[model samples]
Target: MSTPRNVQQLFDLTGRVALVTGGSRGLGLQMAMALGEAGAKVVISSRKAADLEQAVMTLQDAGIDARWVAADASKPEDINRMVDETMERLGHIDILVNNAGATWGAAAEEYPLEAWDKVMNLNVRGYFLLSQAVAQRSMIPRKQGRIINVASIAGLGGNHPMMRTIAYNTSKGAVINFTRALACEWGHKGIRVNAIAPGFFPSKMTAGTLAAVGEEQMAAHAPLLRLGDDEDLKGATLLFASEAGKHITGQILAVDGGVSAVTGG
Candidate 1:
């Protein structure tokens, strides 16, 4: 493929097809909007059909060619079905966003084994399963693809004691390396893999933590002195998904408002 000479061409996602897991709401929805607005046909997935219906409607309202499938990222059968459905409906997948995940909060000493396994299964294993399926079925044969995994700033190191999410933190730490390792293995085949380690973002997963640690206190840790706004991730997501990041691979880009930089991420 030849390179596009203009800036708009570099950032454009025209004619691409993207699949985003957990795309019904929160950061997943935000990134889906970015991809759709840039002209990619978008497919979003979540465990709930009702949520998927609502999300599809929202995207349609915004004039995006978006739709959804109901699949549990944690299950292998469900993951395969998602890929099958995407192929049947969209024909091919050019970009895959592994954004589906779970978080568990409990003191390290009291964390339940079941909860730990659940978080690990969904956050780490689930990502690998889905990414592998997409690559094998779509990217590898075509020799072109982009995979974006959503890690967390907590993965860079230990979190505040108040966070108390050992399993979630550990899984994200693994995700950082998973991005690097996959990029190394797939780059030769024209696949680019990378991760975004976001700082505190307002979502259902973080609501409890934010409530306990207040928004103002959370913002104070970052030099920017503010929590992530709705549009904060759009630019970074576009960079990775579009030709703007064609040379980049196997890197973890933190969109944490300088919190990771100050905290040694």
Candidate 2:
């Protein structure tokens, strides 16, 4: 057996390369900062070049080796191109954070099929395609990789009666299982798959929901009596991406400030 590493050593990501989708802002950018701060070279991707350029500048200001690629994670061709470009630039991928997602607000009965398809395509299908492409091209051959999927408390079960997002809930639920199934299949291939299910965090995606349900009301619902902040996800993101969590796989960790703990999400 090998000697156990120190905590700092276990969490260090020196010389690694991380690719984060939907990384222009919000949770995706949060996770990217965590990885880059830990010494990994990070490449962030999104559909908007201007947003990505701004994000990359912010990351660079923090002393992180970072770059950006503008590609829509929802499209297969985009996914392939992004992966190919990253591989060409970075040589190999050590971590993949599948954080790109979409949501639609409509009652189950009145939900449009187009909306459902859009959410599912970007949220579920995009993750699978990106994972497959990254693995087949880089991770598999190296026999080492870390995949962190961004799930949500919404995936645990139904949301508040006021929230009408059947497709979002469904896609996230699928993501949870996808993490488990992919972890099981890829374990022997040296890839660890895990997920982070966040509760209400103020972001571009949840801005509407936050406005609909007053932030204070949402905060009160959580046992912690507050919503997640910018730094909330850093610890978990580093854990899953670094050697600190080497033995951990196929787990759904809810970073919801105990909301999921009480609500059973």
Candidate 3:
């Protein structure tokens, strides 16, 4: 391997292409922008075309080469179509961010079976299917790729008194291990797989839960005593997407402001 002469070169992603699921907003968009700003051509996906369009504009406004496709990441056919479209439009994909996810909050007894299935299908199954599609269609064939799964600090444990998202938590636990197993299997093909398990972040997904529990109280649980913001994910995304993390894989990074380390009282 050629050693990078400068620090910036390690994070440089010129000529690379990245696809971020759920990149229409929130954490997905944050990571997408990170890859884009670092010189990658980025394609974002979501279920809504309007959201995707707006996000594309937002990225372009920020001077990033970005585009989008509308598809439900949970559906197998949609996943396949999105992959085909991405490859056709971008020629090849160097990075795939499985950031698309869904969450549900309810007392375990009252939690409908439907909600369980919804969360599991989208959060866990969706990630696997997309990653598999990308690997088979492009990454494996090219013998080069990066897969960054968006896990959560919630996956590491189950002690959040403020939230009752059982399905989401379980799915994320699967994601953490999924990243590890895939990395070990795909390393021989030059495909890197890793995960970023974030803490409480300001987003539509967390709005309801934060409202019920109060954002301040939630933030205080973290050692940093704060919720996540737009830029928190950028550096980590770049690290995994660029040459900076070429030697790193099968790892789960917690961007949770130290929340994962503390247990419930």
Q: Candidate 1, residue 183: CA error in Å?
A: 0.4
Global lDDT of model 2: 0.96
The regions of model 1 sitting more than 4 angstroms off are 1-4
TM-score-wise, the better of 1 and 2 is 2
lDDT of 3 by residue, 109-222 (tens): 899999999999999999999999999988999999999999998899884787889999999999999999999999999999999999989899999988988999999989
Residue 44 local lDDT, model 2: 99
Question: For candidate 1, lDDT tens digit of each residue in 52-74?
Answer: 89988999999999989999999
Better of 2 and 3 by TM-score: 2
lDDT score for candidate 1 against the true structure: 0.95
Residue 111 lDDT, candidate 3, scale 0-100: 96
Find the number of clashing residue pairs for candidate 1: 0
Rank order (by lDDT, best first):
2, 1, 3
Clashes of 2: 0
**In candidate 3, where is summed lDDT lowest over 10 consecutive residues?**
256-265
After superposition, candidate 2 runs with Cα above 4 Å error: none
Please provide, for model 2 over 67-93, each residue's C-alpha lDDT reduced to its tens digit, 9 standing for 90 to 100. 999999999999999999999999999
